[model samples]
Target chain A: MPTVELRFAALNGHVRTARMIATAVSRCAGVPAGAADEIKLAVTEACARAVRVNRRHAPQSPVHVALTETPDSFTITVADRGQSGDEVAPGPDGGLVTASTLLDLEPDSAAPPWWSEPAEEESEADGGFPPGLGLALIEGLVDEVQISRGADGVGTIVAMTWHTGPAVAPSDSIL
Target chain B: MDLSLTTRQEGNHTVVVVGGEIDVYTAPKLREQLIDLVSGGSYHLVVDMEGVEFLDSTGLGVLVGGLKRVRAHDGSLHLVCTQERILKIFRITGLTKVFPIHSSVEDALAAHE
Candidate 1:
């Protein structure tokens, strides 16, 4: 179980890289291809959410993605600097909540979308949640999603976990 | 990924079997192909996805777009999804509700009547 750290802007290329990392993790962990894709989508959404939140402080800040695999589970963490209201608050539960909603799991009823469309006046206050359905999709696919804030308001950490199940060898072909 | 679109007459329906990943980068190709089928007065489109192993949001958008175009042309679009992964995506996005899906190409053809 080695860890891979990837730092990049929340760009399209990193989305593909997140997928590749998921495939690699699944290959190494002996998971099914579909499961791997689900993991990849969840992690990619989390990273994108982090970048969206970071836009308030450092719009161009490079988001950091860490993929770590253990014997029993694989964890992908997306981190970026931003402070919501509580400096000592845990990682963005709202983000994880969005991810869970995508997975069809119930998060806090009051939680809003992770990323919202930029509003005319609110754009200066903070990029309020962008109205989209991505977070809900991520939540539906991932098993356990958690959010934790750093001690010094350095960043928010969104972690997604996929547990090892009955090993399904990758087939030679998808179809 | 290689996508080949061919029209085969199954009684009164035209079946177009697509073979490849229908994603964002490749969806435009699918859009073009579907547009040709519709604009050329070719209706009764049945997409055979036996060879499609993967699909993403962009791909789904293209399919939705195709559905809209086909509807406007007074035609219908059907799907032949045999691949589990692809089917799963359809089901997750509730696309199975939007399009008619059959177990196989033969089933799709038979159901058209």
Candidate 2:
């Protein structure tokens, strides 16, 4: 097996570098071209989430990304040294403060469009859209996903695996 | 890595041509542009993603936010994307059903009209 590890500041800008490294490693590990895209996006999401969490709780910490290639699959693990909350919480103004809230704060708008209403319902049922969509996308793009607390229970680790074969068809249940 | 955004008006719609990768780092720029457009009363938007090489959750979130902003004003946001890799992100996130996506600028404009 071959492994690669990287540690970088928990900033949004570093997410792109993380994705680039994942793409390069996956390509070198013989991951199919189509699956390479999935790996890139999944890793990017995981790193982005880690950055957000670290920024919220431990601004000085760095995000750690590890990629390992086995004979059967490729594995990626993104870790953050921030306080991990399993659920997305609303800010004081009743708006979500998850990854989506990284955008500038704007006045609350009316209900989302009809097509997007289902997503809001799904978010309510699953907690919220930030973690919900990010994890759902990772699960949809990869063969397996495992989220766990970091050693010593200080932060979060998002580990995803992709088999060395054809990519799975994306499921409609992601929404 | 680098993102460039240019806007042109076609009748009642504002078409934004975006070029480059959109990730956590660069998404804020796109977000600011979209918000400025909506605040300026250019509610109807068509974003051309054909030149986009990469998009992640942050980028997607920005688009969703833009959509909500425009929808609040009884306006609409459409996406022009042909790259399978970029389209796959929208499909996986189930945003394909949320925003009207077209393969070409012409198709997007036609649909908006």
Candidate 3:
């Protein structure tokens, strides 16, 4: 397996750079061209999520992204130094998430058009999008996704995997 | 490219022409503009994103926010986007059922006309 590591400050500006890198690295790793946009969008979402938490809790910490390529697939791991919560499980092998949760992402169209905290609705803080939206998008973009604790068991690690095979359209989630 | 927002009027709809990528960083800017547009009393909106090269969840959040704001006034917010890449996000998030999406600004402006 070959891997490329990128460590940058948790800033919104770097998210686009990370997306571009994911695209280039995917092509080099034999990921299909059809999946390039999905990879780019997924990488941006993961990095943006990392940047968001890091800015809130660990302003000095950096977002760690490891892009790995194997004969079977390519994996993008985005880790943040912010405090990890119940949202994370054990190690990747010990606990994994069911991407099926993505299917219910927008079940109630009658609900709020965007996600928001009932308590914070009056606070005007970023208008409260669902914390799971990012993960939902990543799961939709990749072949497999795992949300686990970081190496030191302190922060969160989101590992998104994409196979170097026939393209899987993100729209398939609608099917 | 960075985000560039330009607003124009068409009939009763306010068309916001969005170009470039709308990710986390730029999404805030878009949100502010949308809020201002609604605050300025323009309820019906048509967001033209034909030039948007990329859109992430954050951008979607802003669009949703805009929708809710307009809907509060019993108005509508229509989206003008034809790109498969951009439409894929809406499909994956199941937002296609929430907002009316049109392929052209003309169609969006003429949505309820």
Candidate 4:
């Protein structure tokens, strides 16, 4: 299958453009309206996280986004060239803290009372991760998620897949 | 896309109508407006995001910050968002539980009363 790829500087402003391109490509690939919205949000979060991660560790590196349409799903891969140390590092108590773990932090009591408390066991299952709402949002919007280190042993790669229909493999190829 | 904000008085509430995309680039604009409204003693705020074409984590952060700002003064902040796309962002971040989201400004104001 053919893939659509985009490369841009690791900057906050670029996330919008990445989302626009992802939406366009998803639409062209015949993704449904509701699923297209999911793709848009999921891709935006992925790209934004990549840009932020790159800026923190490898300011000069660029963020890369690739979109591929398979028979049963649309896959988006966002990769950055920044170090992934903090995501995998141990916490002060020698326990692993994952992205979901960071989200488990309690909201300030004096602040708004509506902020919901995190589920206790959620973070421990995912391991130590980044401290933000981005990853959690991506997980909610997509069907499958895989986080891994880049092939070059630097940065992070977030691969998200949204199933277009039932999980069965297509009898015929669309691409 | 760029972001634009317009404010109007609806009875005892201040209604802020937001337009365009709300992402990292445009979130600061919304943040500044909310900050000004809170610091200026206008606490009962209803943000109408029906015109928002896009929303990301940055936008979510600003809304959360605005809620905290208003709550500090014993005031309240409500959201008027009907778009599923926009609503999905709130739901995904678990903000739906935090924000008093209404389908329209009138509904939000009515609830405020």
- Candidates' interface RMSDs, in order? 8.8, 8.9, 5.3, 8.9
User: Which of candidates 1 and 3 reaches a greater lDDT?
Assistant: 3
TM-score, A chain, model 4: 0.71
| CAPRI-style docking class of model 2 based on DockQ | acceptable
lDDT of 1 by residue, A1-175 (tens): 3478878875544555666666686677655554766775566556555655666576687888877877777788877777643222222554433422442324353554222211232132111222233445455677786667765667777677877655634433243
Please say which candidate is ahead in TM-score: 2 or 3: 3
Worst lDDT run of 10 residues, candidate 4 chain B, spans B88-97
Can you list the residue pairs that collide in candidate 2?
none
DockQ rank order:
3, 2, 4, 1
**Model 1 agreement with the true structure over B1-113: per-residue lDDT tens digits:** 44556677776677887886554345567877777777788767898888875565556656666666676667778998867767766666555656889988788877877
The CAPRI classification for model 1 reads as incorrect
Per-model TM values vs. the true structure: 0.64, 0.81, 0.86, 0.81
Residue lDDT tens for model 4, B36-101: 898789989999998988887777777777776787777888999888778766655556767899
DockQ of every candidate structure:
0.07, 0.38, 0.43, 0.34
Which candidate number would show the highest DockQ if scored against the true structure?
3
lDDT by residue (tens digit), candidate 2, A103-155: 22222634443334322312321122345456556766777777778999999
Model 3 in CAPRI terms: which quality? Answer: acceptable
TM-score of 1: 0.64
In model 4, state the lDDT of residue B106. Answer: 91
lDDT of each: 0.62, 0.75, 0.78, 0.74
State fnat for each of the candidate structures: 0.00, 0.28, 0.33, 0.23
Candidate 3 global lDDT: 0.78
lDDT of 3 by residue, B1-113 (tens): 89999999887779999999998889889988988998899999999999999899888878878877887777788999888889988887777776789999888876679
